[model samples]
Target: MRRPAHLTQGRYAPPVPRRTLDVTSADGSRLYAEVHGPEGAPTVVLSHGWTCSTAFWAPVVRDLADTHQVVLYDQRGHGRSPAVPPAGHSTRALADDLVAVLEQTLAPGERAVIGGHSMGGMTIMAAAERPELRARAAAALLCSTGSADLASEARVFPLPTPGGRRQAHRRLLGSRAPLGPVSPPAKWALRYATLGAGASAEQIEACARIVHACPPGVRFRWGHVLYELQLTRSVSRLEVPTAVLVGTADRLTPVVHARRLASVLPQCVGLTELPGLGHMTPIEDPDAVAGRLRDLVRDHLATAPAPRGERPARQKKEKTA
Candidate 1:
C-alpha cells in the first residue's frame, strides 16, 4: 500500500531511536526494542497492538520523548522481531517478553508507567501477576483492548445473530490471506473496521502501512490466540493503578469491553471514552492517547516513592545543606 505523502514524513514516520537492542524472551523469542529521550528520565514503555510495530507509536513517542525515556518494542513476529515458534504465540509469552524488556532496559530500582494498545494491552494484563511487572511498572494504560469476548463482541461480520458473527469472525481471524497493497478500497475497508468515520487519509495510510507490514503467518498466529482470548482473570490481578481508554465507535472491541475493564481492574483509575473513534485509539487520536499517558506518569510514576537504596533529589539537597 502506497502511504500518503504526509505519512511518508513528519509524525507519521517512525521516530529515531537513541538506542536499539534485541530482548530475548523466556521462550527464546527475540523482540526488537528501541529507546528514546534522555537517560535517567522518568520512563514509559509502550507496546503496540496486533499487526502493528513500534512505528505505530510515532505520534505518542514524538510528544513524550523530549521529557521521558520512551521505550518501544515490536511484539513477537511483528515489525523487526523475528517470527517465533508456534508454541511461543501464547499470552504467557507476551508476559515473558514484557518482563524481559523491563529487566533489560530500566535501571535498578526504577519504575515506569507502561502503556499498551490492543494486543499490547493484553500483554500488560497477562503480566499483571509477575513480580518483574510489579517491581518495574508503577502504572499502566490500556487502550482499545478487551479482556475477553473478542470475537463474539467484534462489530465485524454484520451478522444478526451472535453465534453467526462469532463464527464468521473466527474464520476471518484464522485466514492466512495476504493483505495486498493498500488500495483505496483497502483503505476504506480498514477505516470501516478500525478507525472512526472522520479518520483522515493520512491516518488511514499510516495504519495501513503498519498493519500490512505484518507477515500473514504471524498475523494468523496471533489472530488465533485473540480468537480464543480469555484474560479477565489477568485483568483482575493487575494491582497497580491502571486506566482504560476506548472509542465509542470501536467495532472490534467496543466500549463495553472498556466498561468491563474499568469495573474489574483491582486499582481501576478511570475510563475515558472518545466519541466516534474506532478500535485504533492511539492513531485515531494521538493527542488523547498521549494525554492519558502523561496523566499516568504525573500521578503514578512521577510521584512514586524513590526506589529502595536510592535517595530522592530533595533529600540529597537537604542533607548537603
Candidate 2:
C-alpha cells in the first residue's frame, strides 16, 4: 500500500510489505524479511547499514516497489530480529544473514540486483567470496560505504591531527553509549554526523527514529566491526557488475571511499557522487538511488525473465520461511 503522507518530497514513511517471513542465518540467527511490489517483476534486495533496519529502506522501496519487487530484512538485532550472543556481531555474521535472506526470499535459482548502504555495503564486501553471493547477485549497488579505513577516513569529529582524528573517530565508532532518546539535541547530532546540511527535518526525523531504535549492545558490537574493518582485498572478489554512489558531504564514509571502491571493483560500472548529500544517500535522495537500481536491472536483468513465485505442478508459492 502506498503511504500518501511519505509521498511528498523528502518525507519518509515506512512501506507496508506485501508479504513477510523469517529467514534463518548460518549461525541460527533469525532475520525478519519483507517483500513488496508485483509478482514477475525485476527484483532488488536492499540491506541497510549499522543502527538501521528495513525501515531505513522505506523511501527507496516506496519509489521502486511500484514496478520492482523489493526485498528488505532487519539486520540480526535490529527491527523484529532478535539480538545475538556475544560473538554474533561480526561482518561474517552480516554476510551470513544476507545469504540467508536471499536464499529464503528468492525462488530457487533466481537472482536479483543487490544493494547495500554503509555497513550494509561493507557486508557485501565481506560476503564477496560467498557462494550464495556469487550465485545470487546479478549486479550490486554499494552506497556511502568504505571498504577500509572507516575509522581513520571518517570526518565526523574532525580533530586537528590525523593521529588524533583516528583515535577520536575510533572511539566514536566503537562507543557503547546509549542514545537515550530522539530529542532535539540527538536529532541535531545525528543530522550533523550523518546527513548533509541541506537535509530536511523530515529526513532527519525518519533516520533518527530507525538509528535510535537500535539496541545499544547491538550498535556497540557492530560499531567495533566497522572500527576494525579491512576489506581492500575483498573488493576484487565482488566480481559482479557493480555501481557505487556517495554523497559529496558524507561525513561518515566520504567521497574518497567511494572513489577507492570504484577504482578496485573488478567490473565497476559507474560511480555517481551527489552534491550536498550525506551518508544517508537513499533517504536524503531516494530517487537517485532508485534510478541507479533501475539502471542495473535494465543493464543486467533484461535477459532474465522474472520468476513466478510458484512451483510447476501444484502451483504452490515458493517457501521463504
Candidate 3:
C-alpha cells in the first residue's frame, strides 16, 4: 500500500494558489495540504476520496473560498502524503489522521465543517469516533458517498469481474505493472463503460487524463479496499448536523446509497437529488454542489450559535435566479 515513486506527487497541482501546510503523520509520513479563504473564518476541511487528491476539489473549492476557510489535502497514499504500507491504510487509521490534522490546523475551539466526495465522505463519518474533534464541527456533508452496507462494489462502478478486484489490488501493491499507460482507446472505453451512452468526449478526455496519471499502484490497491468496505455502521454514528447529496445518474455510489444513508443519519437535514448528473457531481456541477453546501452551512449556523470566543463568521448567500 506504500505509494510507488511515480504517483507519490500529484501529476497536476490545483490550478489555484492557496497556503500549503505540512503535517507529520504519527509514523513520520509527511501529509501536505492547501488552505483557502480568510484565516479567521471557520475552516471547511474537504477530504478527497480514494484515488483522488485535493486537486479533485478544485471546482467546489473555487466557489466557496470567499466565505469559508477551506482546507484540502491528499489522503495518505493518494496525493502528496507519502504512501503507507498497504496494511497501514484503513478507514479508521485515516479517520485518526483527520482528527490530528483538524487539531493542528484550526485554532483552539474552532471545529471544521467537513465534506467528502467518496471514500473521503467515509473518512469524515468515521471521524465521529473522536469525541473531542466531532464536537467541534458544525456539520458534515457526505456527497456521492454512503455508509458500509449501502456501499457495494456494484454501486461504485460496474462490478469488476470475479477476482478483478484482486488483480487491481495486486497491481497497485506493485506486484504487477498496470495494463499500460492510459491511452486514447482506453480513455474512450472508460467513458463508454462508466459514463453510460452519450457522455461527452471532453469529459471523457479530462477524466482519462486524471485516471491515467494516477499512481497505478495506488489506484489498484484502493480500488480493492473500496470494494471490501462497509461504511453504513460508521454513518449511523455521526452525531453532527449532516447532509447528503447525490447525482441521480451516478453509476458508482448511486443515489440509492445516498438515500439509505440519509435514512440512518439522525442529524441529516437535507437530501439533494441532482438529476442528469453522475458520480462526479461536485466536479461536474460546482455551482449546484456549492449551493447545497451553502445551505447546510447556513442551517448549522442558524440552529446552533457559534461557540463562545469563536470568530464571527457567516455563510455566503446563494444568488437568487
lDDT on C-alpha atoms for all candidate structures? 0.87, 0.86, 0.67
Q: Which tens-of-lDDT digit does each residue in 159-236 have in candidate 3?
A: 456356444433333323453555678866556433434446555554554555557667766666665677677778
lDDT score of residue 162 within candidate 2 = 66
User: TM-score for all predictions?
Assistant: 0.92, 0.91, 0.80
Q: What is the lDDT for 106 in model 2?
A: 89
Candidate 3: regions farther than 4 A off: 1-13, 149-182, 193-202, 302-321
Model 2 CA lDDT for position 147: 94
Residue 163's lDDT within candidate 1 is 89
- How does residue 121 of candidate 2 score in lDDT? 92
The reply for model 2, stretches above 4 Å from the true place, is 1-11, 303-321
Q: List the residue pairs that clash in candidate 3.
A: 1-86, 147-231, 147-232, 148-230, 148-231, 148-232, 156-252, 172-217
> Cα miss at 43, model 3 (Å)?
2.2
